[model samples]
Target: MAWSEADAARNRELWTQTNADYTAGSAPAAWAREEMGWGIWQLPESQLRVFEGIDLEGLAVVELGCGTAYFSAWLAKRGAHPVGVDVTPAQLETARAMQEQFRLEFPLLEANAEETGLPDQSFDLALSEYGASIWCDPYRWIPEAARLLRPGGHLVFLRNSTLVILCSEDEVPAVERLVNPQFGMHRFEWPDGGVEFHLAHGEWIRLLREHGFEVEALHELQAPQDAQTHEAYDYVTADWGRKWPAEEIWRARKR
Candidate 1:
């Protein structure tokens, strides 16, 4: 189902609260400096870098749902002209603070990912790591991303797999048995008024195709049983990730 305005408001409120809560601590800054990872497993991007073949130097890139703009800043450091877009002002504030702290200059826009006012075909690449693609409705954001990208431009995002989404519950740290059916499970409502999104693998392919995206790669990230669990992400366990895919990365190109 498409998210209503009420759902948008609720999600905004939820993220606002979340940003405020995280801002009270210093962990986010420290974690931002750590290796780039997909999810709780925190698999190092150095070994599985998504932008490996793509040249980012002087490219126009945009990061959706860039909470602290760390990834965008990283892109800027690589010589990409980066812009960070987010809905929550608090989060953008955090991004601005990080910009100052790191002495990097980048624009951070307070805008919803689903309807960012960025010009059409304005970006050479778009990125989201555990960001807009996971929280916003893909039906909306996928097309928005297509609109933003130049032809042949790439869109890469990381999100929780449907397997993980099915097995988890809001505010619960452990990944137990499946709590929801796989088929037709698109929206997950949290008790705290937050709404998240997920889709079956085939559904994602269809959606991307419909939005003028050519599927390039789909990676299901798994962790080893001995891999250390990320203390910050309480929802997923190493054992569970070892047994099942916890996160997925999608690499697509605007066709």
Candidate 2:
């Protein structure tokens, strides 16, 4: 059900510890670097196709709520001056180590988006893939992103659509209920432990406008027919994946 004070406290503690581990050399949880084909960098290849064509050379970029800084590193490799920010020191530490291991250099900041204190219009672009956009409240973040960018700067993001997540179940009945009756995202709690939230299609679009972003494009990841699937398929699929335009690859500009 609902998040408890104890649960939030424990999550905060774990998040802190995890970030520390990241900074100290332990890999961030989501990246799964040890896995054979599932490295976090796989993002820019497919989910972020738009970035494939952009010239990032020498641009000042920030990876907000960057978990392991993989995206930041990737941007740096493309000649962008990428800076990564996250709430967990451990994760930043892991990012630092990764930077050293790869002979890459970029800055990392430990701060929350709601109060980053980074200079206004400091960055030319902001990139976040499955990190800050999904877990944190965008109601506060839209302005923070706007504040971080110049008047014409861009924000690129990827997030699971509410519909894709709800229809992930194999049963036709459940899928029908999600698509027809409910037609929205559901807050789910894991059996092992932990609670997560999701946003609906209209809600996402509304939040962007509320924060003053001029929406450029929003659509699905559009997996190929022969694309590989994650093991979690048995549990849930992102609503955006069902077509019907669920989850999104979003690009917006500060007006």
Candidate 3:
């Protein structure tokens, strides 16, 4: 189904409230962390090295579904010209606040990642840590990312692994065995009126190719031994993650 403005508004409303709750949680530390972390487990980029070999200096980076935009702040510190885009006003507000707290300044736009209406071929890199990767439909946002990037520009995003999705039902923690079919997985409706999208591995590869992106890597992420499960992200236990991939990062270069 197409992601309509109403759907975007609902997601915005959902995250606006969620962002308020994050103020009392780990969100603050995430913004100010010495190193970049990915996903619920906050796996260190130092070990994963997702962005290594790619120079960030002076690159025009656009972060789709940027939420609080901590990643953008990191990119800015590394000398990239970063712009954060999100549909949730509350999230963008917090992002703005962080820019001040860190004494860093970058553009933050209140816009949907699926169709940002930004200029074509305007960015050298498109990033979505957990933002558009889960919240926006890949069919929509992947194309938008391609259109936003200059030729050979990169796109990187992180999302829940398909294993976690197949092993769990709505709001329940993931189990050891598959609970859902793999073939027709895409749009998922949660009990809290939240809609998330997940694609099979093959499907993601195909979609990225369809959008003029050459698949560079798919890093199925394993939780470190010392990784702790937080109450906010009770979907998958740390043990389960260590045995099976809980999150993944996809890297692609626009053709």
Off by over 4 Å in 2: 1-48, 168-197, 232-247
**Residue-pair clashes per candidate, as listed?**
0, 18, 0
Output the TM-score of candidate 2.
0.74
Q: Residue 163 deviation, candidate 3, in Å?
A: 1.2
Ranking according to TM-score, highest score first: 3, 1, 2
Tell me the RMSD of model 3 versus the true structure. Answer: 1.5
* Cα lDDT computed for each candidate against the true fold: 0.82, 0.62, 0.88
Give the lDDT ranking, best first. 3, 1, 2
Q: Which candidate, 1 or 2, would have the higher TM-score against the true structure?
A: 1
Residues 113-194, candidate 1, lDDT per residue (tens digit)? 9899999999999999877888888888898999999999999999988888888877875466888789898888877777
Q: Indicate the TM-score of model 1.
A: 0.91
Indicate the residue-level lDDT of 166 in model 1. Answer: 85
Clashing pairs in 3: none
Candidate 2 lDDT, 106-169, residue by residue in tens: 8888876545789999998887776566545565566788889887788987766555566544
Highest TM-score scorer:
3
Between which residue pairs do clashes occur in model 1? none
- The local distance difference test score of model 3 is 0.88
167: Cα error in model 3, Å: 0.8
